[model samples]
Target: MQIALTGKLAKAMGVELEPVNDEQNPLFTWTANWTTVWDNRRAEDLLVLVNHATRFTVAVYQVKRKDLKGMPEMIKQAIANTLLYMNINPEIVEEYMSLCGDVTFTRNSNRKAAAWVTRAGLDTSVYIGHEYNGIAKMFRDTVGASINYGLVNYSGKFDDGFMPYEKMVTALTELTGKQAYKYRAFELMVTLDLDVYQAERRIIVPAGLEFTRLHEVLQSVFGWRNYHLYDFTFFDEKSERTTVLTEPLDEYWPGDEEIVLIEGRVLADFMPEHGTMVYTYDLGDNWEHEIELLRVIENYDQESPYLLEASGQTPPEDVGGVGGFVEFREIMLNPDHPDYETMKEWARFWSPELQDWEMRPRAIRV
Candidate 1:
């Protein structure tokens, strides 16, 4: 039935009405909520058998929901947990192998509906089932041995398993407690002197920064590359003659401007400096065991560089030689401008006193 008719059906059957239509309206208490077991599973992993087993568990549970909201959520969570314990935990590829498992009934005969868990952009929080299919019948122990046996024998039926969240979660779990699964990140900053049209790596000074811990923060802030690629750039740049105490952009100091940023500490501190155009806190690296990895990336990416001042001895020059240091003494920023870009990007920049690096956000992304 159409949405209007569905509401009318609910009203006519006295199905206990709630805001199931207009999002602003609160929903009634009769929604089916299926709780999905959430683990960051990417599209196309190898946990289909486990996922299928979880689906089978959902089918066999025979759980039914009166409301639409909570029912799917409950089923999703139950199934995910079951899949993890039943198939994923055992490390078997085919579903038939799990016919004999150390399975115990966390939920037996209490559920009466089916919950689908596919990465096809299927409903995430809940799946309001239209009908109970193959997986649904499994909850009731209704899937015969013939059908169960076919799953192990058939290859085409299991292709989607390679692309679902089930396998991703299982694989991630297997990879956990290892460096490959841990948080890995880096930052890149590029500062441009508007007067010279020459850009280099630089970070924000303390006066323009505001963070309790500068090292720990990772953020994305407004930045300047080619002005057309990002937001607007300052036409009025600060001349070298001005006192650095004045805001960098007093006369349009390109490196001294700020940009808008999505809020967060991990992504906030390393956000692009407005005029400087810095990009930091980059996760997922392409190379291992190398300092100034970003500089290498900048050399190859053919993308505009973000301002990264502390990159200690500006990003290695592309002309087969390390560029000479661009000293703060020559610039208006200050003689004491911290080489934060270098320290954050490469540990070699850390001095004896500044070991175990940790910093926080001190500038606005905008």
Candidate 2:
């Protein structure tokens, strides 16, 4: 039974599970057997299994009654408490409830049960002698599904052991028959003064990503700590006007310049294939980065931005600008300079091997 369940889950997750080998139990079959001890003894059964290897869990339960309608408040509270105990986020619980509303339950002599789980959080579970094939099938069909965009970045902190909200929404998109925008992959060449410095990178991201998210990705790719203000400027030939997208800093500078907030605008709203723009970081330093839309990738399956290729290390933060970097480079190269040791220490802090200026193509994961 466990083997069958695992196979179903693997199919949903687009992955394969290999058979386990044991020296002492070499003849053991691949089939999984549910221990009798795990069977429910009480009127209600609630089983929660956490698998840290996959960073997810499996929750299965069976109520005492056959009908789901007019379920007692006590039973609902019990389920809610169990979910809280499992550290599942409230947002995920809400999404599950929303999806559950679409399912039509059929009650029969056999007990009725429902299971909700997904890859990267919940997996799969089966109840004995239960008429929940519909619910189980729904869960299995949407496993391993990718979403257009993530509600929040997964930074390996405060993990709620649930699949991302976007993934859940995507999985339910087809079932709900809701119209959703298809995300397109974009390949861009970002250069910091290609005419002189020649620092550049190749990045691929989804068109659905917000400009703010793109800003964060640029900081990661350029090795910037994001300590200063930045803005994106582009010339719209159709509109025949220069558009500037920047953070809202009304308190700092209440100028007449029309500055569009980057929070809600998506990349595809303004950037098209072969489009070009300029990104200025650190107003004081006036560091300008040239951004060119190289290509548009159709039917790509990735959800997050990736650093495809990078060349020419980024300048150290707060190093006065391009001119400052040039001066610092000269001092570092000349061992006889008065501040050579100090500059060398600073350079080593940013790049341990002093490879800050090395122009080499490399693959980096963000």
Candidate 3:
């Protein structure tokens, strides 16, 4: 695995980085800079390490420039801790790994990590360069608290998303266990349970994915713009209890049942206990869906969500509810009808080619 270092850090440590290659397993990257802190002028240096696959900041260190000798050990310890947290044995990781990649000085390499650290409240506290900046203390305490208080609360694009702590716990557990079973994926049958039409899709996603990620995949498969609120409802027959997982909201609506945010909850949490669940999107329109767990795929290696099959086209958003969609479909089918032109024009808001609608499975990248 390649350990990417900043140009300045490599120069200071007198280390050379090899050229980039297609076959290298990039594990993590490091960036450091000697900069002024508060009233001090270039008194301390900062170091940031980011995981390559998850794009999550593994650790951050702030110390005097002269203490650079210990950075390598600290980085190694951080990597080991990260692997342990992910349930991946460190020995397995070290078996096929090499040190140092090309010095990454590009902005795109570390921008996401920098933004994540800032949003996590790690860069707020300030101190003199020669004194304690409290970054290490703040990061540990905040991360511990945040893990329980909605850890993977991502309100952004799928590619920019981070690997949630809860998700990482079980992702690599099978690797370290005695069982010969490999990582698994879930084959789901997501159907739009509307009276007007029969729209359904078959998708496969990593079992370790959070409900939020699943929500994104659903949006992509259904051709929705995701401009409204949504929730998942699961019912247990034996206990006769109903659980609702919704997006993190500023103010939750009044209800008797317990409401759980989908942020930190992985799909594996409810897959074994519940075979099916209902997803309701756009409360105003009430687009209800039935998601059934078809089966668990053993030894699955696909990292991203994949579309296995699709049936029928998803209706345009805000085409009213079922009744409205039924009427719209009738108008669309009868091209010679008076409202055909108007209906086609309105549907273009969702897709440019409403007349020739087809499901493109490759478009579902989430």
Query: Which is the leading candidate under TM-score?
Result: 3
lDDT of 2 at 351: 48
Q: Per-prediction TM-score, please?
A: 0.17, 0.51, 0.56
Q: Is candidate 1 or candidate 2 better by TM-score?
A: 2
Query: How well is each residue in 1-366 modelled by candidate 3, as lDDT tens digits?
Result: 345555556666555456544354433343333332344444444454544444344543344566666656655555555443332334444431233422333322455544544433233223222224444432221111122123343567655544444344333333344321236678899999657657888888777767876887898778788878899999988988889998657677646366887767988999956899998989888998899999898666433467877776777889898888888888887889999998988887543232232455542433
Write the number of the candidate with greater lDDT, choosing between 1 and 3: 3
Q: What are the lDDT figures for the candidates, one per model?
A: 0.25, 0.50, 0.58
- Pick out the ten consecutive residues of candidate 1 with the lowest summed lDDT: 282-291
RMSD of 1: 21.0
Backbone clash numbers for all candidates listed: 85, 1, 2
Model 2 residue 262 CA deviation in Å: 1.4
Best by lDDT: 3
Model 1 CA deviation exceeding 4 Å by range: 1-176, 180-187, 196-219, 223-366
Candidates 2 and 3 compared: the better one by lDDT is 3
